[model samples]
Target: MKHVKIAGGLGFIGFHLAQKLLDEGWLVTAVDSLENRSELKLALEMELGRNAHFTFLQTKIEQVDFGDADVVVYAADNENRAALEAVLRKCQPDCLFVFLSTTDVYEYSGEWRVQPVTEYGKAMLAQEENIRVTCAETGGAAVIIRLPTVYGLHQPYHLKLGRQFVSYEDETGKTESMHDLLYIDDVTSALAAAMAIDSGQHTIHLGSGTSNPFERTGKSNGLDYQKAHELLGFFPRTSLAEGIKKYQLAHEEWQRQKKLAAMYDETKSMAAKHPNTNQ
Candidate 1:
């Protein structure tokens, strides 16, 4: 069982990916700040318990000691500098480093002459030099997955993915935003596949293919979602409807937890005022 280290494994994408790896018989080491206790993570911990071959360290990537892991998934970021620094420090001389970058970098914005990506895409444009320098110095093979807006069962509320549903009549409808919503499961599966590939193809677009380009309706971008089957060999198994249902459930659970916390706080305050209340 090859060990793979995910730097921000406590995050939405990383958390799901970690579970996928566990199912696939890989020894997984997940490192993250776990800034707040995530219900999904707690649930996973309970479900997987001692049987899962996993190690979760509650700390940032830069703080952890990267023991000799076969691959390093550089999922953590503290702006550009800290991001590159973590990679350089954690990567073994011959390790494969996979970076989860964004497709957002490709947009120059506006409805003008947009360029197709070459030598990996525009996502790496800003931090390209730093990435190259760090990888070169470490003698590590660096792979980059330029991904789009990922949505799935556990989509975090903090992503601010605009309003969930927008009607055509609504002036501020999300349909106008025109973004590709990549399923989280697809993202996780793609990374696991990339890790398995024994090739030098270090850069690949982990998207739902051109058929599912950023669009409100299929006609908006002249994209036919059906093409994902042929081109990317990827069809989102979970539809937006199913994914949103789960997301809504997570949101409701979070609200419930919040209310419980408030109620407990009030009870504690009352108890303090009446010291003999327990007696």
Candidate 2:
């Protein structure tokens, strides 16, 4: 089985990708700092822990040994640039390094430029440059996937927004803002396809290939996904309605679980406070 090391495997995209790889019968080593938004970490651990092919390591990328990995997926944020570079140095000569980049590196017109608008974009651009240079010097195969706003089940912010919108409409009768969303499954599929290809160096942009005016106020327009389609055979398969329905179902289930856990904790606390009262 192919051994893959996922940096930030506890993150949103990272966790999903790791699960997909594990399900596909690949041996997956999940290296995470456990520092990212960790609300779903326990849930993810509970779910993925059942797989015999999965392993979780709570540590920084720089501290791990990448010599045994066939593929290294960098799913962590730009803050781990130093650690990322360290991993690159220690990675096996034949290992494929995949970087999860963002569309923030491009201009509003969806054109690649040297300069980025936001600070986050600037950092991501720098991270991408570092990966490109390191891979070039080491003769390592690399793939950079620039992703758009990804949405799906267990996505914290978007799910919160959906719940807020429903409550807002019920209370104040006003509609909340929508987002230009690409389902998480589509992004995972694209990443998997990118990993399967043996082509040397590639930078691919991933999106729904169409602008949604209702979402993000038209900021999702002009992204060119031709390279992704032609090279990786990736295309968004989920429609907005279908994606939203799936997300809603998953969100409801998650909420139910959350409430049940909270109630269980409350009951335990109460029982501890009145140990002898129960006859």
Q: What tens-digit string does per-residue lDDT give for candidate 1 at 36-145? A: 77766765554445546988888766777675788778766524567567656776776777777655444433321224243233435545456667777766676666
Report the error of model 2 at residue 149, Å. Answer: 0.9
lDDT of 2 at 10: 78
Model 2: per-residue Cα lDDT at residue 229: 93
Q: Which ten residues in a row have the lowest lDDT in candidate 1?
A: 169-178
Q: Pairs clashing in candidate 2?
A: none
Candidate 2 lDDT over residue span 204-268, tens digit each: 87767666433445444535578999988988898766777887898799899899989999999
Cα lDDT of all candidates, in order? 0.61, 0.76
Residue 148 alpha-carbon offset, candidate 1, angstroms: 0.7
Clashes of each: 0, 0
For model 1, what is the C-alpha lDDT against the true structure? 0.61
Score every model by TM-score. Answer: 0.67, 0.82
Model 1: residues with Cα > 4 Å off, grouped in runs: 37-50, 78-80, 108-124, 158-178, 198-201, 210-214, 217-279
| Cα-based lDDT at residue 7, candidate 2 | 88
